[model samples]
Target: MKQLAIAASILGLLACSPQGEAKLSAAPEGFDDSYLQKMGFTVETVEASAIEGVYQVITDQGLIYVADGGKMLIGGRIYDITGAQPVNLSENAIRQMRQKDVAAIDGEAIVYQAEDEKYVVTVFTDPTCGYCRQLHNDLQSYLDKGISIHYLAWPRTGLQGSSYEQLKTVWCSDDPKAALTAAKSDKRLPAARCDDPVDAHFALGNKFGVRGTPAMVLPSGELIPGLVPADRLLNTIKQSQ
Candidate 1:
């Protein structure tokens, strides 16, 4: 369903609730999220928000907020405007989520290290993406600038189909780095199988808010979507830090 329509449905429910209905405990230790499930959203975590009576929820669709005992949903970022520049509380939450998830990949991702690494960036890539290949082909530019790149699989076509299968073949190969290089070059890779992390990588990409290939997550947990040049990436990281 469209997000706006879903929101309207939830709001309609909120309007129909009996007056003086007891609210869900601020501490929802045993919270029920069946309403969200009915709405087709898989709930991951539910925690009290910084605001009273509002709760923060982590779901497959990213972070969301709810109230009125989880029946009413509110969307959009929460900003703290007390500072000279407005601080995006939601971005902070998402960034921390990205950091933990990106780090969890460990050595699973195909890594290109620099001799004198100053920054490490994780990139969600799809072999079929021309820009993804361009980024891979120009790795030396990033490496030469003391930036190591870690590549995690993200099939733009999703978790099924040829793109997904091809990435799995690359991850399953005895030499993943070589296979990845070959895949980007449009060369046929020998069919292989293993306990691949491609699906896990794909899930992580979704949680990391990647809508396309060549999504880069810097060490500072900032997400830059799309193809970024080596020098520009370095400058971006420098500025963020």
Candidate 2:
């Protein structure tokens, strides 16, 4: 089913409930979550907003707003301009969620440890993505800079067909790292399959709003949505620290 887009009309900071009462412990009693689920949204969280009656909804795709007890829905990011510096409240919440969700899959990732590692990054990648290949070609550059990279598969095409099957082979191989390099280099692999985390990794990538390959997740849970050079990435990490 085609997913519904966030309703444009409700995209701003609407009036929220009073302070203290503004925090939603859970989806409001009057809210009908089924309505959203039916619209092809995998809603992950619902929280009360600073705006009266408005609620912040986090979904696998991104942020949206709901109001009037679920009668209205708006899709977009919201910011608090009243703060000393503008705060993207929606992104902040999503970042926290992203951090938690990415961490949960650590055991399942294809990890390349950097010697004397100073930072770790999780990356959503597709074998067919040119930029992903570019990053892979310079994989050691990141390691040289003391950045460990944990890779998660994210086929642009849905979990079916050649790409998915190829990634599955990489995950199932006796030497997954070698298999991955071979696949990314456009080499065919010996067919293989087993219980693997490719599906879970793909799902997690979607939940974190990964629209394309080479999406990098920093230790701080901030997402950088492209192939960043090792030196540039190292600088970014240092600046964040």
Candidate 3:
């Protein structure tokens, strides 16, 4: 299956500050993330983690934690275990980033607008994937429930293949929606090219951590990584409000 990938390192995010207390950051402390450059990561921003000394380093690729003035790299999420149910502080930070990224590319997506249009969800999809095709096939079901679908291309094989070319044709087509439908049906698309958003969409999906096709970004910026039924997705959107 193909996939797309988020925004805090899901945009370079600010430190997660505790409620009633101001947020602290590592940048002002002159913490050098130049060490990250040695590892080939473009350092976007660095912020203080919920942990006392750990800093969340937001990079062009994704989020990572460092400590001891960038001497240590912690490759896992931070959780507030003090709560009755564990809250993933890292995930929360990334979600906010996703919201910004989604907004930036809002109109570029291939959309299926509902009549009432109660909710909008951005989906990073690949016509090459079975689940993605299924989701496309159920477009009317989703639309009927007032759920509008916006599709972003994510070829999933890292952008160099027939699949990527096929998807590009869809975005570059005179009638993108029809081309997309044809592609999903395994019909060969006539080769076409333009200033298509296909490549940009793929990169955005990768940043959003789309590991597979049919990754849906809910209205609240939370990423749901699979094919979901229309009725259930509607309920989810309502609950998120």
Off by over 4 Å in 3: 1-29
- Off-target runs (Cα >4 Å) in candidate 1 are 1-27
Which sections of candidate 2 miss by over 4 Å? 1-26
TM-score of decoy 1: 0.86
lDDT of model 1, residue 62: 61
Q: Choose the strongest candidate by lDDT.
A: 1
Per-candidate Cα lDDT values, in order, are 0.80, 0.78, 0.77
lDDT of 2 by residue, 202-224 (tens): 76776666778889998877888
> Taking the tens digit of each residue's C-alpha lDDT, what string does model 3 give over 46-140?
87789988888765555678898887666668899997999999888877777888899888899999999999999998888999999999899
lDDT of 2: 0.78
Error (Å) of candidate 1 at residue 146 is: 1.6
- Best model number under TM-score: 1
Q: How many Å off is the CA of 222 in candidate 3? A: 1.7
- Model 3 error, position 49 (Å): 2.1
Candidate 3: residue 156 lDDT (0-100): 71
**Candidate 1 lDDT over residue span 70-115, tens digit each:** 7777867788899999989887887776787678776798999999
